[model samples]
Target: MDKMRAMELVLEAKSMKGLTFSEIAEAVDRHTVWTTSALLGQQQMSMTEADAVVDLLGLDMDVARALQAPADKGSLDGPVPTDPLIHRFHEIVQVYGTTLRSVIQEEFGDGLMSSTDFRIDVERIADPAGDRVRVILDGRFEPYRKW
Candidate 1:
C-alpha cells in the first residue's frame, strides 16, 4: 500500500479509536512531534516504532511497512501554501526570514540550524483577552567549518 493509503487508514483508525497523537506517541515512547510527522507520512518510522504504532492502532503489516518506507519530505500542494494557517507560517518567513538569518548569524556565527536535530513544542496559553498559541522550535546550530 502507498503512504497516502496508509495515512488514510491511520487517520480513520485514530478517529475510530478516539486516540490523540500525543497518546499514540506516549504509547510508542516517542516525541509527539516526530510521532505525528511519521503518522502524517512526513517521516519514516523504525521497525520497532512501526510495530508499536501498528499494535496500538490495530493496523495491518502493510501499514507498518508503509510507515517504515522512506518519506517524500516537503510534499506540499504548491509553491505557496493555500491553507490559512500554513499560509501564515509562509508569511512569517517572508517577513522575518532575513531578520532571523541575520540574528542567528550574529549570535551563532556563519552557520545554520539543523532541522534533523530540531524539536518543536506547540502549546495553548489561556488569557483574559484571548488565548495564545505558542510554538517553540529548538534546533541545534551547526557552524560552517573551513576545510
Candidate 2:
C-alpha cells in the first residue's frame, strides 16, 4: 500500500483501538515524537520497529513494509500553512527566529543547531491567567570547521 493509505490505516487503527501515540511508541520501545512522525508518514522505521508497530496496531505486513520505505519529508501545502496550529509555529519563528538565533549564537558561538540530533518535549504549565504550553527543544550544536 502507498504511504498515504498506510497513514490512513494507522490513524484508523489508532482511533479504533483508542491508542495514544505514546502508548504505541511505548509498545515499540521508541520515543513518542519519532513514533508519531513515523505513523504520520514523515519518518522511516526499521523492520523491527515496523513489525512492532504493525503487531500493536493489528495491521498487516504491507503496512510494516510501507513503514520501512523512505518518506517525503516536509511535505506541506502552499507557501503559508493554513492550519492554525502549524501557523502558530510559523508565527513564532517569524517573531522569535532572529532572537533565538542571536541567543544561541551568543552562547554557542558561530554554529548551527542540528535538527538531525534533536529532541523535543512538550508540557503544560498551570498559571493563574491560563495554562501555558511549554516546548523544550534540545539539539546538538555543530560549529563550522575552518578549512
Q: Model 1, poorest ten-residue lDDT window?
A: 94-103
lDDT of 1 by residue, 73-98 (tens): 65644477899999888765554454
Q: What's each prediction's TM-score? A: 0.55, 0.55
Candidate that would win on lDDT: 1
* lDDT, model 1, position 100: 58
All models: lDDT? Answer: 0.81, 0.80
The 10 consecutive residues of candidate 2 with the worst lDDT sum are: 94-103
> Which pairs of residues have clashing backbones in candidate 1?
none
Candidate 2 per-residue lDDT over residues 62-130, each given as its tens digit: 999999999765564446679999988876555445445644664687898999999999999999999
